[model samples]
Target: MRRGAICAAGLLVALLLPAPAPAREAEPRRAPEPNTLVPAGAVRYAPSGFPDRIVATPAEDPSSGFAVAWRTGATVDTPWLEIVEAGDSPDMGAPRRIRATTRALTTENGAAHHHRADVAGLEADTLYAWRVQGGGTWSPWRQLRTAAAADAPLTLLYFGDTQNKNASLTTRVSLEALRHAPDARLALYAGDLVSGGDGEDDDEWGEWFDATAALRSLLMVAPAAGNHEHFEQFEDTPRERRVLGAHWPATFALPGNGAPGAEQTTWWFDFQDVRVVVLDGTSALDMGTARAQAAWLDGVLAGAASRWTIALIHQPMFSPRQDRDNALLREHLLPVLERRRVDLVLQGHDHVYGRRGGLRAGQATPQYVVSVAGAKQYRLSDAARDTMAPVAEDTQLFQVLRIDGDALHYEARTATGRLYDAFSLHRAAGGARRIEEHTGDRIGQRDCPRAATLKGRTDRCWE
Candidate 1:
């Protein structure tokens, strides 16, 4: 009788209890494996199982998509990405999973692995929190915000060759770029991210990546391949020469709409209202590739319905350095730029600051610029002054390009935050564009302050 009473009480308790909620399905984790890569030498350059050198780059379409490339130790075979729409509250739901494509780059330096994920189908102007998984380990969630719709205002930070001494350099410029234009959405790196093509994996690249980690984490870089990006190992010839660096292709995955031979290296993509074309100047100039690129450029410019088109290249159409005239660029590329009425042209490799442009007959547009962002400085020649006004020397500068409807303001500032040069481009009737120069101290005279002693300092330029 007592047993029957106890069973009746249990049944009564069950009837009084609340209904159970469905449990959420948990995300799957990768199985762990032992890491065996050694640390003694550069060989098997798998530094760590954790991801390093993570960079977020713009896909062909910035408003809808973006890409992430990162390196990790070889132990993690199948790296993947977990991304979710970032929310204000901490109780966000499970993220969507996207698999990564792995490229095994085996260099004499070591065996390094590069993994890239092109995230698409994203909402415009939405913030996302994403993290990568290297085997069982996971990186901290990093946040990225997609670009706004087609008609939004565009702002970009422009910089020149950050080639050699990069690890010790470039970061300051990157910070300065943010300091000047914090709302800057992207950076135009005029190629030569490293000094030499040491191998698939090298120290210079490590330094370059590490130093720029802070800025690249926030901004997507549109990089072109400068001369230093190419290197070749010729067993047949005793003389050693550099060809396109091995890391160039793997490191940067730009848009694939460039010339015939130059694919990602020379490409064009439109963000907001601006169309940015990054050309492979080194390949086009020396390797008889200019014609194809010019043809490709014409098509790109013709098809681009954007309000503004800007061309970015490593070699200058109008050379700042006396010895460095890009005749091929002038003959092949200049006509297309002029015909397309491109608003601005950004170039590097002269290691000096120069700009030349004005309203010309029949509406020839596109102002030319060559600037240096690193500590390496070159002298401004007298002949360049005829074409370029307010030419600067021994200066490291960062340029901010702001594009709004009907007007674009361009400002070039020194590393120490001095306005070195400024100009404005106004879109006129039909398709013609006009330039309005910004007036300031004009330009400080480039007088070589000769070996005058300054406050116990020997052999310095007297300001």
Candidate 2:
């Protein structure tokens, strides 16, 4: 009788409670915004009558000559370049006008003309101001200095892939690097300058140019072709293939003394005491130019007369990612590097920072470095973590190389201009090389935890 009375009381309490609220419907899912590096309502990259995208490239003999390339509207044909020795007077001196070789190109952004001028017989280590003419107007004079004829102290800037977020992230890194080494003689880029190479992403090229506009006009650029520089052709078919993008040839006037088929992509130049050899790893891997480029590298290194030899390529021989090992590069190019005893190998495509002193023990001739200068970051492979010392991930970096006498000093700096790694390679008079690490006081390695799922999503560690 007591239990029944208790149950009746509970039923009366439940009946008095308000009815349960109806289930709230899920809000409609919003579509994700477009993934674009360009900002809203940004100025279009369309070419005007005035010249744009001006750049200076090292000549085969940089001591006496250099090449300049620019872009203008398609209608602005018959453009020319004017050069004068920089002097203290505002009146300046008489300028020498050189006719430009213009090539008409039709890109996804419409039609434009690319002009190249080869200015030769300039004084060594002398500064010259030059400009290009388009539609009867002259571009602002840009200054470039010739390489010294003899071996001397020099400074150079090296950057990995500036492939993504070029306008914002890359611009900061590039400008910071310029601030750190404003007088860098030559800037070496390890390819993948832009993320897209499908011929439709012309704006990316413009962003790349804008990011490095200051440096390009001031220093010589030596760049190699990364895989991303190749454009897809005959898409969605078995006959589909990759070809070198048209913008590459239109952008920089590289020394055309490379492999026969890959002349524009692979080349070498002498800048003071350093011999900068740029190889087309993309072609070597995809286009079956491995043996040819390897042979060329061997011959170039064998006949190198410079005090220092530096090789620039896109693919890393010792990849920071275990799955990214390039057997083709290792088989064809590694032997050439080891046999030639190249002093330094600067590479990209790993999207991580790794420095390997030598392939074997008690050897320090070749120092392999893979770095990135873009927003993209990759997780270091387990093998890289175990073997590659002083490594970093989730960091954008640039390297400054200063060569004084027999010693080469290298410092890797973050986007904020903080030194992250440092080292020095000293070459003895007897031809032996030694490496000294200066990374003791550098900031700790930047890394992040691997994603927990196959979708590859993780929080950004750089922030």
Candidate 3:
């Protein structure tokens, strides 16, 4: 047969064949079971003869000294820390050993002891290497720099809640923030570092420590207390009482100079040109310590000697979530903050990002910011959406603040190290403060589909 005729006959016969059926849709995967205990193959973070969760915190006067705290097994009855001034040579010259103040702490996992050592009388702006000894074993030497005695330029890293998914999600943001500001003198956490606040959830605390291990060891930590840091006294009690979690006291060695009743959670310290005042917002709201805290706050700010004052509280002055409002805080603490003219206020607990300039017109002294650095996110309230500029939802954020003489620069960056918002506050010797917003070529605000508007609702807002 001819080639063309043969080909045409074969094509016509093939065209008559039946089409193949579509592949069956894959079955939907079942959700995994929820487990509160440490996952398999994960580090248990059980206390041992060696020190772990070693954290460095600012002393009442950071220029003069700093404090270090660590966790050890109960078997280590007498723990101590050794310190030496860092020099060019490798050998540490004649280290000084200081006895640690050890406190017995019992968690769900096991009994442990937390040891704190105050390394005092150190030279200002000097580098020092220190390590902790539990029993006969010692921790690796870690280096830290003391704050300058004078009003020198400084950098600070501010973080919001790392409450949920610390090891898996929040760790990246925390590490990236440190990489972005390698010279930061202090890291101020707004609060709710761990999800479980009952103080018995050692695993959650382990995750938090894992996320900021390097930060705690390298720089000073100033943490505020959030509502999650408070545990209910009795379940379903009519008088619903809350108390500060036990872990808070054992986790960090903060300055003792705070409000009379809430010393551990409320404290202040001076680092170079700025004064950081950490308030126990949870205590004030739940434990009836608002009036006392307010009085203490006013007194603390009244005698402020630093050129700048920054306040850290867990609850937002201006809430970003519609369902939440801190009327008690606004009533008791807002006045003190305004009257004291706090330069900056960093807060958390709404699971969203918000920044509001001063309430008064032509004034920029008190800038309010609420940010979240964890995976959990919330829907933005209408009021926040309308009033707050550069607000964000479903976004993890970290802030870097630099103070140089009369000018302070602030930058808020996302988890991926992208600048989301920025502003600069400058003051003239006796003149009013001025703020300039950096609104040029920044990333757009992030928002997820509203729950009410979605066709099929999921467990999370973003989903």
Candidate number with greatest TM-score: 3
Q: How much is the lDDT of residue 21 in candidate 1? A: 81
TM-score of each: 0.83, 0.89, 0.91
The collision pairs in model 3 are: none
Question: Against the true structure, what is every candidate's RMSD?
Answer: 21.7, 5.8, 3.6
Candidates 1 and 2 compared by TM-score, better number: 2
Off by over 4 Å in 3: 1-37, 40-43, 197-200, 238-240, 449-463
Q: On residues 143-204, what C-alpha lDDT tens digit does candidate 1 reach at each position?
A: 77788776778788888877655555566777777888988888888876766634433666
Q: Rank the candidates by TM-score, best first.
A: 3, 2, 1
Indicate whether candidate 1 or candidate 3 has the larger lDDT.
Answer: 3
The positional error of residue 440 in candidate 1, measured at the CA in angstroms, is 2.7
Which residue pairs clash in candidate 2? none
Instruction: Output the TM-score of candidate 1.
Output: 0.83
The global C-alpha lDDT for each of the candidates, from Candidate 1 onward, is 0.76, 0.86, 0.86
Worst 10 residues of 1 by lDDT: 30-39
Off by over 4 Å in 1: 1-46, 107-109, 197-201, 235-242, 358-364, 441-463
Quality of model 2 by C-alpha lDDT: 0.86
Candidates arranged by lDDT, highest first? 2, 3, 1
Candidate 3, 1-463: lDDT as tens digits: 9999999999998888876789999998554322234675455888989899899999989888888889999988667899999888889798999999988988876899999898899999999989999867999988899998656889999999988777777889988998899999899999998878544478888878888887877898888888777788776878777888788888888888999788879999888988888998888887888999999999999888888899999999899886889899999999999888898999999888998876787678799999999877777899999888889988899999999988899999999999998999888777467889898957998887656323244434531
Q: What is the lDDT of residue 339 in candidate 2?
A: 83
